[model samples]
Target: MTRSPTQTGRRAFLAGGAALLATPALAQTTNYTTPFENSTVVERDPSEVVRRNISSFRSLDWRPYFSDTRNGAVLVDTTSRALHFWSGDQSVYKLYPTSVPLTEELTRLGRTEIVRKVVGPEWRPTPSMKERNPEWPDYVGPGPDNPLGTHALYLSWTYYRIHGTHDTRKIGRKSSNGCIGLYNEHIAELFGLTNVGTQVLLI
Candidate 1:
């Protein structure tokens, strides 16, 4: 049978659409590599992993979260998995992705101030962390292996910090024990901008 070119093209397009409709959608997978030495890589389905970047990552006003940007103000929005920083003079502002605590039980929400800032920060597993994972190292000096990365801002609350992570994958995920984690570069910049006595609020 002879068919017009237009008829042939229409048939071909319908066939392609049918093929696409028959194919199942592939689930997205992510490979997570732990920072610990000799740790095995694990593949996780999107649903299995902690939700990240789910909330709006837009710039926020400091007035809503802080009374004033005195000595600089840092606001960690656990729901959004983001960190917002406003300079003391309100000249410099930054927004960065962050990793929050693993679970609600580990999460602390309230006001705290930066009591100290350390470069090349050493790390020691908290007593509770040690009890939970005895296999973890007793101490890790400042280096690539150090989970605290290159810099750390110690908060007034004990065992809590706003620090950098050697594991980049941890950022924008709920992967920390009881701290907020940022990319090393972001933390270095933040470290330089902030100082002791910077007001921090985690909400």
Candidate 2:
């Protein structure tokens, strides 16, 4: 059967993820982030600050990743902070710079699936999450500064989401509290294509 765009993305991601798994001998298994400059993987703590400025930011973007429409299923490797939308032959990848919680909770739930999608997602901050530094802006409008922009794909693994960030400058670097962030248009497009049962390779 001819696979859909999302399906193509999922296959490509799985292929890459499989290769990533098998190439432990060839590929560098111990990847490090400047965000974790002085920290140890074993010492990851959500409370521990691994990235800076992300403590408070002004704008976010999602237009880049959603440049094209999704086919059917997509592969999003959170550990690598990359999103892959596979089209049968060629594949598109977008890197999202985010700081994951340096904690067992996140590590233990790595490489999981992305179950659902949302557009112009609403925000609901936890009391504790809000207490941790408290600079996260209250619900804001989409485009250039909205924390949750045009779309947000929710991960069933945890309350975390692969969402569009108002802060696009942070892409390709570590800077989230354990969520996959994207830019407005990018995620908006992905959200439109993504559906239930779509695979999300967290890495």
Candidate 3:
């Protein structure tokens, strides 16, 4: 299929194999401890400045269990910090930890689907993010240091994503604005294994 210029550009950018896990120098210095404190002290690794903000990813109970859905489904258990990909078989699945919280507004429980998939996706800071950091760049080109990592599965929801992150340490916590964050390697694998329109269930 002939992709539009934007898609073509994205594909080309992704084809370059961007890193996706490096923090922008500006982001590295902003302190997340007091998000709205108006402090410009420039703390190191601000996004990952604190691990206690949410549950640790390592503490989650991850194991194979039965799901009646026999076709396929992407199961996200925020409470357990795990994302399970069920392969239409009750017995087969690949489990990865949930790296971000299900923000109340972004939660679309029940059923949804993957609307789109892109490799080396660009990073566009949300409005709230801009409010927090006015100095943030309007757009981050696709590359290794891009916040979206190496791949992204855009959900049916207006502003939700299952994508990779620059900071792996933020995994299994309430970090992202509302999207599901995954390690760069894990997302690359998931991106290869799934297709558009795959079922996604957040609970």
Instruction: Enumerate clash totals for all models, in the order shown.
Output: 0, 29, 7
Q: Rank the candidates by TM-score, best first.
A: 1, 3, 2
lDDT of 3 by residue, 108-153 (tens): 5566888999997977777976896788778887876677778899
Location of the lowest summed lDDT over 10 successive residues in candidate 1 = 23-32
Error of 3 at 85 (Å): 0.8
* TM-score to true structure, per model: 0.77, 0.50, 0.63
Instruction: Judging by TM-score, tell me the better candidate of 1 and 3.
Output: 1
* Ranking of candidates on lDDT, top first: 1, 3, 2
- Model 3 root-mean-square deviation: 16.8
Candidate 1: residue 43 lDDT (0-100) = 25
Could you tell which candidate, 1 or 2, scores higher by lDDT?
A: 1
Off by over 4 Å in 1: 1-51
Clash pairs (backbone) in predicted model 3:
18-144, 19-144, 20-144, 21-166, 71-88, 81-98, 99-172
Give me the candidate number with maximum TM-score.
Answer: 1
Residue range 1-51, candidate 1, lDDT tens digits: 999999999999878765543321111122223234321122233223343
Model 2 score (lDDT): 0.50
On lDDT, the leading prediction is: 1
**Candidate 3 TM-score, C-alpha based:** 0.63
For residues 16-133, what per-residue lDDT tens digits would candidate 2 score against the true structure? 7665333211211112232112211323342332333222221212233334333433445444545554432223333333334444353434444467776656765556556763
* Span of ten consecutive residues with least summed lDDT in model 3: 23-32
